[model samples]
Target: MTGTPNTKIAFKNVRRVFGDGPSAFVALDHLNLDIFDGEFVTVVGPSGCGKSTALNIVAGLLGVSAGECRVDGDIVTGPGPDRGVIFQQYALFPWLTVRENVEFGLKLQGKEKSERRKIADHYIALVGLTDFANALPKMLSGGMKQRCAIARAYAVNPKVLLMDEPFGALDALTRVRMQDQLLETWSKERRTVMFITHDVDEAVYLANRVIVMAARPGRLQEIIDVNLPYPRNDELRLSPQFAEIRNKVWHAVYTRSGQQQPALEE
Candidate 1:
């Protein structure tokens, strides 16, 4: 499950503006980033610092107001099967059973019923949801629902996984478990991953490199290399190396947040 170590996605001088004229708000400004093939990168920033905005741009859900976003050298103009997105909200269809929810994308791809079922079953088992495969979304807990969401996103076998706070909604204990599950899944799948989160510790633990973003015209403030061994576990969380990286990320975030903004001219 080692990454290819080549550039898989790139953002060049990217900017995103919502609305226009007097009501215009620039969510991201001159954002530049490069995500390597099969690499796991986590982005952390203040609430309004465009953490999700950057992720959406890469997912092709939102258009950049300036510059360009490219996946494997191709400009990203729309959502494609090559990318899988998991949001904070589970977004599962209550009417669909767990297996059916995972098969949704494969079905749309015109995959045969038998083949779809095979793929669905494999990912469901991967997420430890085989026992609940026949269960409905309403019957599951918050953590189980998110597991379903992960299985659905991975069932398509996307090359790049875009996760926006996928574990944010779970309780403390469940969040830790989900984090472990995610690492195990990613290790086996070896896909390029970009995760967005507000938790500095989560960012440090999960990412190969952590991108710290500044507020206002959101932009990259710092990128901290994790330099930790793979097959990471909860024990790593208590390691001094983990604490070091976490503190570094926190310092960057704190310094940026405390900086005064320039005055606006009338």
Candidate 2:
């Protein structure tokens, strides 16, 4: 009604169980989440907390055993171009040029050679790698390679961007830079994105909303509305507000892990 608007993606009593019959292990338990279009949401929790599994379910790579996951008003069935995933590992083709790798999806769609080239270059430049468009994957830095991977995902123009610790492989400094670059690119592209990361700080820094999940037999623990304005840079990271969100998320994680909740910093 007059409260929150309708969600672009909705998980209705979703339950995901792997294997079959008695052997089935439920990853998500009666989970319900609503993600609005163009929203930047981050899932953070303990390892193997079904965070990635939730992303996979939304991507249609996995199916729910008990409920339905809907995207744009339709139930999810299987992997489709509507979702683009970026994994922790830079899943780039070592053989393909940055441009070729970025445009690979368009090429697969049988777009003409020139068409693919134009599309690829646009995304390459979007990631600030226009000069490296001709370089092979092995030649780029770890951060640059991930940028290409991000560009590759963005090139497809998916309705949702699913990222699983996409910066988990980079060094601390590099990770920060990548976070800034991702925010930069996302601001321009405005695609609905769901990212999974274990870092509470990263989750709070980038997300418009942060979802914290419980451990195995993973279930939603808390949903935090960041409500932080755009152009969030390192300066924002230094604010007391940012620390408050981080501490809140950290406490949630600690509590979920069966440990005492951490105290908030003064």
Q: Model 2: what TM-score?
A: 0.93
In terms of lDDT, the poorest run of 10 residues in model 1 is 257-266
lDDT of 2 by residue, 1-266 (tens): 11136577788888888888888777889788888889999998877679988999998888888888888888899988888999999989899899889989988778899888888888899899999999999999999999999999988889999999999999999999999999999999999999999788899999999999986688889998897788998889998998888878887888756655545433
Off by over 4 Å in 2: 1-6, 20-23, 256-266
Scored by lDDT, model 1 comes in at: 0.90
Q: What TM-score would candidate 1 get against the native?
A: 0.94
The Cα local distance difference test for each model comes to: 0.90, 0.87
Q: Output the number of the lDDT-best candidate.
A: 1
Candidate 1 C-alpha lDDT tens digits along 135-220: 99999999999999999999998989999999888888898889889999889878999999977788888899998899788998
Per-prediction TM-score, please?
0.94, 0.93
